[model samples]
Target: MTTRVRDDTWVWALAGLALGLFGLGFVVRWQCTRGACALGRHEWLFDLDAVGSLPRLFTTSLFLAATVVAVRVAARSAGRRRLWWAAIAVVGVGLVFAKLVSAHSVVEGLDGRGLTLLVGTVATVVGLPVLARLGRAWGVPGARAVVLSLAVYAVAALGLDQVTGLAAGLDPSPLPDAAATFVEELGEALAALGVLAVVVRRLPHPAER
Candidate 1:
């Protein structure tokens, strides 16, 4: 008999992680300003200031979550084993505690074109092998879509702000700080959800337990 786990296990796990992280960011923002949250002044306290780096935090966490998911799904489909997930559990638990401390850390956005290029290029190179392995099994069913979605996500989540900054720096058409934050955070959330969707789609499903 093939060992099987419910698809809902990972589905719920990833969903919860994303929502919980997003909420934690909000809580930190709220507490930082004691809930003042005025339009002009509160923006910095939220995520634009040097009070914690949501972009780095979420992007790293979510990317790690994806790695966990991919490794888990691959293991499940390839073998009847589940022990590999324990590694992810360790990091996830540690991160839960780290969030509180991160509240006081400097706010860092996905700035720096050089950093962006390096991260994107490295992720693509590392991911190519994994995707190829999946292709051998899933046979391009949804792999291409996942790649496209994640590419769009990376650009939207990590690159938009840099572009806005460059434009503003060059021509002095600066966007309101609040508006910029909103756009950046929105991109982060959307990209996160998109990646989760792709991961969920790739997980192997059994018709019945």
Candidate 2:
């Protein structure tokens, strides 16, 4: 028999981690009025600011709770079709979070930068499941491709911002703060992908059971 674990467990854990880290960012924002100086002074607080409150924190929390239930229900569905739904939910929420944290000054309206972000968001929504499916079939290289794609997106977004003079980035060397935000979002996405990879690696395939 295949060893099947609860999908809700994984979903809830991911949601909780996301919420905690997002909440911590909000805390850090509050504490660091003078840019990152306060944060540097209270470096220990980094533990707390790991994930500051996610955008529309209350709504996101409710959605996450619902996600837990959805994953549980999907796990028991006829063909596990709910997996696609769960994947979409994860990607959609991730895109929303990215939109929220990204520097908007570069792409405030429905212009060039905004269009680029929209296209990237759509690509992410489509790419995640494809990446997952590929990972299961091709292993590490497939996962690496997904990560590299994300990094590329980050770089492209920063480049667009620079060309259009949208926002500042955090890169000390050359990129502005807005570009830095894109890199940061990319980092978070990579981290999320890592967690998903671990979960997929541990869970037994449906046929194995």
Candidate 3:
């Protein structure tokens, strides 16, 4: 396919919408627990709200946005094929992962070995296919490189979380810490990759290959 380069208004719009929805989610979560549930008032608006934190919001938004971008990029780089199913898988699994991991602090009266196992299983089943679909969209040639870049991003996010934790003295325990770290890192990575993919495609390819 001949690569095309131009500013896709939809891409920017999608990014803005994703970020806005994320901020909205935070407000909703804050209001829900504080007002409706009567969980006692806490500073969430500016205090990074324990509801999910910046990392979670950033990562999740990136993930969703990346999925949409991936479908489009796949169509351009590969071919114009319906990648909605892949989008669904990626988005669905991500939601499940967030829900499962968030249960500990976000939900009450729900903590057991079996339950964690079940949630993990569901997330795995869903996430695997989602990743696989993303790979397909990326195509065999570039899939490994994309995934590797994403992995590196995830690790960097973890490092960032650690730094943030040290400065803020947030929860140090492994489970919650790791979960939040993963969410943020993965999300940022996906969004970044989506941008990079578009930029790279737009650039003129070398004549040799």
Question: What do the candidate models score in CA lDDT, each in turn?
Answer: 0.51, 0.45, 0.46
**Candidate 3 or 2, higher TM-score:** 3
* Alpha-carbon shift of residue 158 in model 3 (angstroms): 1.7
Task: List the candidate 3 regions with Cα displacement exceeding 4 Å.
Answer: 8-42, 52-58, 71-92, 95-141, 168-209
Q: Quick one: best lDDT, which candidate?
A: 1
* Candidate 3: tens digits of C-alpha lDDT, residues 66-162: 5555544445443322353344335434543553255433332365334544554565456545665666764544444454444454344334544
In model 1, the worst 10-residue window by lDDT is: 100-109
TM-score of every candidate relative to the true structure: 0.50, 0.32, 0.39
Alpha carbon lDDT of residue 105, candidate 3? 35
Candidate no. 3 TM-score: 0.39
Cα displacement (angstroms), candidate 2, residue 203, comes to 4.1
Alpha-carbon RMSD, each predicted model: 7.8, 12.8, 9.1
How many clashing residue pairs appear in each of the predictions shown? Answer: 1, 23, 1
**Top-down lDDT ranking:** 1, 3, 2
Model 2 per-residue lDDT tens digits across residues 1-209:
44555555755665566556545554454345335545574543442212333423433343344345335434643343445435534743664464444434334554756576666666656775575665455433234443444445445544544453434333343324323443443344334434343334433345632
Candidate 1 lDDT by residue in tens digits, 78-156: 3322332333234334433434343212123344455655655576557644654555454544566666666666567
Compared with the true structure, model 1 gives a TM-score of: 0.50
